[model samples]
Target chain A: MDELLRPLVPQVLGVLVRRGADLATAEDAVQDALVEAVRRWPDGFPEDPKGWLVTVAWRKLVDAHRSEASRRTREVRVLHDVAQGPVEQRDDTLQLLFWCCHPALTSASAVALTLRAVGGLTTRQIAEAYLVPEATMAQRISRAKRTVSEHGVGADGDLGAVLRVLYLVFNEGYTGEVDLAAEAIRLTRLLARLSPEPEVGGLLALMLLHHARRPARRDADGMLVPLGRQDRSLWGTSLIAEGVDVLQTALAQDRLGEYQAQAAIAALHCDARSADETDWPQVLEWYDELLRINPSPVVALNRAVAVGEVDGARAGLAALASVPDDVPRRAAVAAWLHERAGEPATAAELYAHAASSAANLAERHHLLREAARLAPDAPGT
Target chain B: MAKFLLLKHYRGGPQQRPNARTPMEEWTPAEIAAHLRFMEDMADDLRRRGEWVGGEALAPEGAFVRYDGEGRPPVTDGPFAETKDLIAGWMMIDVESLERAHETAAYLSSAPGPGGRPLEEWIEVRPFLEYTPPVVD
Candidate 1:
């Protein structure tokens, strides 16, 4: 609930971990300290919240360790000395993020731990966002922390993994109690600031550019409005401008990554006044750059769509041949291509088939409608 | 109160509705979005009525496995071979009466399909064998 508190979580955690606190123990103490803050901080603000959290969490860590290991006067003396003195909080947020997103953990586990330690989201909030039971999420986080503690992602953890985890968070969308997309943007903004990596800026730009269209992404009844149909008037100009600015800055660095390339495509879409007015040639070019950076079936599938717009529907259909049928939504893309190619009958059949295997109700219904539109009785429901 | 499982099938159902005989793929993107919204709206409505239990849409791919032996491992087969049934997904609901359950199933079956027309797909409703509350001591 408190925006400021969540960011400080990883900052203070970095301090505790730096002082030789066990990763799991330090995380637990940090969480406890956060709980204490929620109850007491409203009464009166601490002179320095980060410092307060660090001190409290350190004390908890010391207590836990004291209970586990016999009190060596030497260790206790060292702990007491550190506790008594002024606590200094440094920006260990980036390092903590890298460690939390340890390569040893599965992406799901990495996401859970990162949201807790680096993103400062409560376990309950994270669980709610993921649509999993709180206890299940707790197990996931703790297990991830265990894996992290064992593997020990030494100084300067994997940046790629960190970015990937952040990307996954952003893509999880506005689900349940957490606006994970917003939270992702916030974290990426911090990473961009702390690390100064072009990819970090690229990621932030990509998020902002996509998020800028949030208002027009849905219709009055909360139905998803596809990009082509979305009202460009409802798009957030400020966010788009900020995203473009960030993207340009990143591009100027002379380093092109998937995020930057992807952001460029998003930027092109944002630049359009109308769907028909979109610069398809530029979009297709960017898709080429994206393919060069990250050549996957998903990218190939998307590139096929861009090909349709730039090279004509027939060419798009030809390009579609390269994408494996097993890839999700391949049939849908084929149906759209056929529709564009003026084969309404073929498109309708394809749409009907795709609907049967549609991933969700929305997709299924939409495909069904497309079939009906092209069927012999076009007017019938 | 009783609980019922409402099953949706991808390949097999009790005779398909003529209009919805078409698959979901042919629907326009807007139609798909509208159809999904309809399902979610139904869920939300059920929740408001205190009849919602749980629901999920399954991915298209699946396999049926039969346990073999400890060392041999399990044998696996496609979700359907000769068997025409290929379950797509399902919804579970708790209702005040069997009639309510049927009504809920009917409501789900009425979700908009192609041409903004009601799907009118037949829902196979089966009540839960046990109704034990999952409360722990």
Candidate 2:
């Protein structure tokens, strides 16, 4: 039932917005319609759920305007704007995405609006996922809608910002009761359908590739498992195949964006039969291309790790030196390099330091385990 | 998101700030009331932001207890740690980033002490380890 309504949330909201209802009011109207549907739809699913929602939401918007606009004689035209929306249901979903990710809004505001309008999530759900107050999230979404409405423009929303917001949603993974990563993938898939840009396909492919590896990311006991140590058979073959197909199609377009480059790297890893069988040289080439595409410190650090895999530990360490020390996981990478360089004591010490500074419990525990493993191997033990 | 524990110490920090020079007992009752009100207000503000998880003030005294055998408990007296022996209290907050955690901790540190002055105390911020599986490793 939820899957049925998810796509319609944005379409209905878009309809209301197109009818000259303010974006924020349109969102609230959609929300009210959703609540009414929750109450009424259990008896029987609406024949046209989108149409039902659009009518309900549009009525709500009209009622709201009547109560507020009774003071203004000119606002009496609200009735005339009543859309024959159910019959004229041209998909306005892509425009809604553009509206939510409008350049006038901040990234945080855009993210909140995108989640509520496109992802069909409640304000409370997004708040819980983001660890913010429900009121704060509500304010952010409303403010974002108003910002976009006031700065109303054509379909010129920065797709890059939309991609970033989607990536952030994916990175948040499952939080509270929301499977944000799955939602992000779903929304990206919709975007890919709407847009002809290869990067959109590339983003969808990248998400699929990473999501496919999620099953192997942790052991039965919920312990963090490094990619090399993960059981290869656990990887989702269908998702991998889908991701590879998407990546190949995107790459064929010949405009290499950051996401396509990243997907290519992920494909390289997925193609390998085993850890030892990985094509490190080819992986290194993608990293270099990624560096050219997006030269971030994190990327540099990741590239250094690849350098270590392709070359020797000493060469890896040299490459790592160029990466800023403040980057997260720098110590962990150094520890790995030192361990492979036959310096157990240095590795163990670095691992311990890395564990102390680790951002999350799993990574801290993993780093501590690495440290403990090397502690006995070192001369002191 | 990260959860951080901001530690307020009874007898800690490398050096005491100027506002903390006078003990709470020596301050006037009005000053003490004002300080407590500041704390309540701060906690209330955090609760409004949905960041405040919990906080509690501790009694001054404690003892180290250990298991002797299977059932017997042996307690040690007059042997407190040379450092961080007395924690006054702590506030737990869940925030978006390390920077937010630090900002919250700084706000807690600015709670009024004796003479209605900001303590500017050193509040220790420790992150709670998250148990969620990584999306990207």
Candidate 3:
């Protein structure tokens, strides 16, 4: 079998699925075919691997039908459907993408399972990557699969949902052993290939733009360094270039969505040679669009930062005031706004509180850095 | 070196508030055995790496005692109602520092167990605050 076929297994599974053959059975049969290839292909290579696997999996299903009575009932008339030569390649992979990211699964499980089953990552590798025990990850994947299967969430038009899942996974700063950021990009590329949707392309661009600066997100002590303080020399220029190119194309399409709005925001950040040079007005405009679509408190909080940059700190604080007080990152955003407004005393107090109450290590470190920068003579130190 | 208590909490510690339970099907015996072996191997590997410390797993049932007026120790029934939140077991270790202690604990928590899942058992870790030795006058 061609080695490339391995990467395209998710695409193959997408193609095999019909209206009657349930997704679970299709996935199992695909795995069986892959296993058979692994066993037999040790000697040499095949001319057409995708066709080979499809043919083999179809046969395996027949053999399976003889013994498994329950599965036989669900099995539809799939004969010439197994032929894989010169087939009209519909964007079937997009359906698999959406199915894996169905809303029924938790955000974490959706990303993990998509990477595993769709991305063809081994369970152990996935577990190790995520800093989870293999058993725990296995159970998570299984549970996610069962949820999708039992809920009968068909592999239909769920591109938007999958895009959200990918974005959520990317935003979870890497605390676990996993290189979640890189994994997110890889999944995004696959999604982009299948769907070619503006939002999917936009997400890939946004992730790339953010990731290009990951080298500057931290310092020697593993403490988080904010975008303003980061050394621009360390940023991945090549990634930024690629991201800009993709985002420009997506923008040309003019099909605005949350990911596209986010990409536009990222594009503004990437365009700035220095943090002070950022186009805050443009970013604020994008955030307005994002808020209109997503309507999230977190988005509103982020929007305030851009407002502060564009319309002065007082204006930003007023914008933030409209947000519900119970928002998770409200204090952190308020602290930054206060600092921008030249109220160091209030900023320091808010930073101290936010640092102590931060949900994750990276954010806590970021808050502490901000606090320390403002109040070096504080008594606690 | 550092010491860790597999420290079952007595009280006043955070517990995971219940959330929706994900339904799972029963695993086959082979799956169960694979999970158990993974855990045993993990513990052995930790010990081989010189990370394992003295450990114990207490029975679910336990006894409690109270002293009153320093006259005599009052014996209480096993599992007194007041002792409902007592320590279940403890592990003691002398690690180089807190980071190493965390690494070891994370390892233990990741070990596979019954139900083909990593154990969800919660263990509290506390560092012993040094106390002044008694002086002889």
Q: In terms of TM-score, which candidate is strongest?
A: 2
Per-residue C-alpha lDDT of model 1 across residues B1-137, encoded as one tens digit per residue: 45689998887767888856888998888888989999999887766444566789998788889989888978998866566887788998756577988988888888888888999988889876432211100
Instruction: Please give the lDDT score at residue A327 for candidate 3.
Output: 85
> Compared to the true structure, candidate 2 yields what TM-score?
0.87
Question: lDDT for each of the candidates?
Answer: 0.83, 0.83, 0.69
Which DockQ values do the candidates obtain, in the order shown? 0.02, 0.31, 0.03
Q: Is candidate 1 or candidate 2 better by DockQ?
A: 2
In order, the B-chain TM-scores come to 0.90, 0.88, 0.60
Stretches > 4 Å off in candidate 2: A63-87, A102-109, A131-155, A377-381, B1-3, B23-85, B92-97, B111-116
Task: List the candidates ranked by TM-score, beginning with the highest.
Answer: 2, 1, 3
Best-fitting candidate, scored by DockQ: 2
The sequence of per-residue lDDT tens digits that candidate 1 reaches over residues A90-186 is 7888888888888898777788898999888898998777654566568778877888888877776899999999988887776567788889899
Instruction: Give the better candidate number (1 or 3) by TM-score.
Output: 1
Q: What is the two-chain DockQ of model 1? A: 0.02
* Clashing residue pair totals per candidate (backbone < 3 A): 23, 0, 7
lDDT of 3 by residue, A4-116 (tens): 65576776676666524457666767778888788887777677777677677766665566467645543433533444345346656667777888888766668777876
Q: Give me the runs in candidate 3 sitting further than 4 Å from their true place.
A: A1-6, A18-21, A32-43, A55-91, A153-155, A173-178, A376-381, B1-8, B12-137
Cα lDDT of model 2 by residue, A1-381, tens digit = 678777889888877776777777888889888888988999988888888888888778777877887776456464545575344666778888887888777666777789999878888888888775676567667766778878885867778878888887788788578888999999999999888899998999999999999989988987789988989899999999999999999999999999999898889888998999989999999999999999999999999989999999999999999988889999999999999999998999999999999878889988998899899654556
lDDT of 2 at B29: 93
